[model samples]
Target: MTIYEPTQEALRGELLQRLAKLSAPSSAKGSVPHGVDSGVNVFGYCVNARERFARSRLPHPAVVVVLSGTKEVWRGDVAQRFPRGVPFAIPAGLEIDLVNIPDPQSGRYESICITVDAPLRQSLRASLNGLPDGPSIPGSFGIALSADLVEAYGHAASALAAPEAATAEAVARHRIVEILLLLSGTHVGRMFVAVDRAEQLEAIVYADPSYAWRVEEVAGMLGMGASTLRRHLKQAGTSFRQVCLSARMATAGSLLSAPGYSVTQAAQAAGYASRSHFARQVRAAHGVAPGRLRSVA
Candidate 1:
């Protein structure tokens, strides 16, 4: 079920038609429609022009379908590109620079991002019958979105648009579970096990990057002693400071990607009082000045 370039083009056409109908006119660019709740949530974004989000962090694993345009993700030295109709999966707690390129003729770039929550990941893993977890890939990787996967997305989208919010949640989860089950047979399926501790810490810090996080406090939340937490992080070759900074910068990058976000606001959102200091950190992390990374329109 490998999706070739031609097949992807045709698939994208059908996906766009389904998503366009499901898409409600959003006042905010890249805003999550239907809200993010529980462990599973679905949202669609349509961009009329080109956009880039630097150091954006995905706290949960995501499966994205590029509807009309293309998505380019930079993970360290590698660049993984997903053109229209190509679906990709990103591991939890991944920080990457993302670009959205609109179609030349249609002048639009749209995608549907579905995040798999912890509970769903566990359920999906258990269904594998004790299969060992797959190696964690460095960044987002493209996967063959077979006919069944596409059908799952269509069902999820429809469920998201259900009149009752509760109904939408229930039906969408069922559909998303089906999608994951189908994905388990792919190369990326093995990476779908429970997220690691470092990833968990990063997600927590990302949820509120502004908070001054101490190792002791965070360890308490994770239900472990400070020493054990430190040992775990030490084995992973990272420290609390590094994790906090990564989460903060990722948060700052995301803020800069939003419309009307100022460098100072982004800095403050990430808990930096000094603009100069924040600029230095942003440059160190993303290799770009905060002002340069600001989103236009």
Candidate 2:
């Protein structure tokens, strides 16, 4: 439950023997081995020990992100020392290994683990700057996840606590995607949707086509540095101008396609000060004149 100081030492004592018993990379004897899911689904909520225990190496990619605990966990040589509120991402390739190093001698440990495939792992790697044009934080063979890691751990814990079978499988996967966005600070919803500036990037451009917006709006909203957000967007193959134009046109097109909404009305609806300007944007976005697009609608 909590991997405090004395607890970690105690866990190591029994770890090897218990692992020996499981044969296929086992965990501490009493801890549940919640079955694997081929990475297509997430296998989660694995508690290895209460006071102390042993575990075996995991067969596939997995990360035992510490939600609340003190311990050392790793795959192969890259050992990570972490505490409560840290979600360390262990790239899912190395040999499974863990050691108990609880805090203030508490001797107890607990964590929320997520299992995803290598491609997702690459995405995480490219997106780690946690913002557009931010520094590129490379994924490691055994590196601990970013300081931003703590955020996603909360979501994983909640989901693992109450998995729903009735929901479509896509719902579950999307939830993981949500967690990844939060962890990376890419999706503005992770923080305050209304208050975070990053949400502005997520803002409906069509809502106000002529409205002047700056990159700072999105960067500020998400509490991320502007440079980082820019770099990330570039790496992800998008520029700020591109996203903004798309947002505006999408909003205007929706308005244009509606009954009783003329081209002028649609332009104003999309926040354009002049219908002519709105028309030009529509042409740029769809590669056709506004009237032409309107004719089709």
Candidate 3:
């Protein structure tokens, strides 16, 4: 089946109307969550209302479409804007600060985010192996959406709205696969299929933060020279030491929030020999003490 490209203005209008109709009262003062909980890989998101600026992380690689309003994302020293009717891809494990602006006339901010986790990436890689060889695709933290991508997103949104559980799941999966196929047809799509070295390294460190991970050892595990690995990470706007620290801090935060997990346990798991050090890192990352994380988590 082919995807249909609708006019950008028309698409934006439709999304705004749908978001206004589905708007619900949220306990959090300036937030409204509108999305389908399909219990599958592909999920939808529509924020009817939100703070002017918010800090958040995707936790996984995702393609986010802005239906209405605008989203400004700042990663490291770079910032990009995804305006209405545009979509962008984000790499995994990056902490981002976001600014969401509503339309001046309508006062609504609506969007949809499709997350592609490890399992989905593996599936895409396997599927691409069967296709004929394509041109090399360079990796980037994000990519602008094409007309094909916009059409595919519209189809996925409609499919996810289906009432039947089985039908919705099947349709959602199909649309995702279709999008991947379309991407694979492009040079950039080839890059998306290949596992990003930075993402892989981050995952490894996150899995076992307690291990003393020397830069040389981590590079050896990836089968690359230490200097080469460092250069690769530098090109990605991060360093090995930063990745390890971020992973450890993220793990510590999760542990502190989990039930029955003590601060000591979190500290140890995050490779912190002292509770004070763990607390300091937690405060730096979250602007709150470790005890506060437990209360909120």
Candidate 4:
């Protein structure tokens, strides 16, 4: 099917209808179940009702397209709102709070988020290897939707709907690459071309938080000198110790929220030998005890 650029109102109406059709019926109030899985690590999101989830950290960089209603993303002390027809790019390895507010009239919020993985980044870098660099944009940007972007998203939705088709994956991959290329023209896109070494190190540590990670050991694993790794991390605005702590805390929070995991298990999974220390850290970072997370989860 051909993707057409519709008027903003028409686009919103169509996206909302798609969301309503995809949403599952459940008794749980304001719960966000999984939406579309594009089979290439990219997923789509649809919300039927307004839901306010607490602060959480996103481990990967994502492009969030707000189709209908609005969303509030809080990072540190700053809060930004993304309304319909806008796309927001979230940086990797940042702690954030998200609030998904549906349209008051329709009582629904619809959006799509495509996660950028290492393979996609490599693909993007290879594609832009010899291109003349454009004017450098900032590492961060505001959310705004354009006519081309809306049409691109509409096409993506269609491709996702029929994953069994031989061309579905190609279409999805192409669209993802297209989006990244458009982003690469901006300053923020430059950041995605090369994966941040510090973020890579953080992911390594996060995957196995129970392992005792040392800076020199991690540097060795990265095939770099300790001092060089430290320098690179400093440039990334963090240190080895900080990354370890952040990863552990984030893992602990996730574990606590999962069923069949006790506070002790969460603490252990986070590499905290001392339960009391784990509790203190969790309370400090999340403003609640580890036990509280289990109840909410």
Task: Please name the candidate that would achieve the greatest TM-score relative to the true structure.
Answer: 1
Is 1 or 4 the stronger prediction by lDDT?
A: 1
Location of the lowest summed lDDT over 10 successive residues in candidate 1: 131-140
Root-mean-square deviation of each candidate, in angstroms?
Answer: 13.9, 18.1, 17.4, 16.0
> What are the per-residue Cα lDDT tens digits for candidate 4 across 52-131?
66656555567776655798887546677888755667665444678888788877676667777766676677788832
lDDT order, best first, reads 1, 4, 3, 2
RMSD in angstroms between candidate 2 and the native structure over all alpha carbons:
18.1
lDDT of each: 0.71, 0.46, 0.62, 0.64
The reply for model 1, stretches above 4 Å from the true place, is: 1-12, 26-28, 35-37, 132-140, 164-166, 198-230, 233-297
Which stretches of candidate 2 lie above 4 Å from their native place?
1-59, 73-79, 95-97, 102-106, 118-156, 168-170, 181-297
Extract clashing residue pairs from model 3: none
Backbone clashes under 3 angstroms, per model:
0, 38, 0, 0
The candidate scoring highest on lDDT is: 1
Comparing 2 and 3 by TM-score, which wins?
3
lDDT of 3 by residue, 1-297 (tens): 987766666665554444233333332224333333332254334454655444454545566666567888874455777787555665454445787777676676666666666666777778877432322211233344455665665576666665456676577678767876676664334334436666556655653577677888666656678999899999989999898888788777767777887888878878889888888889999789999998998
Which is superior by TM-score, 2 or 4? 4
Write one digit per residue (lDDT tens) for candidate 1, span 1-297: 975554765766676666665664644356456545567777778788899888676667788878767999875456788887777877665456899998898777777787877776777767877433221221237776566777777887787777476576777778778888887776466445546676567655654566677788767666678899888888889988887898788667767866767888888878899999999999999888898888431
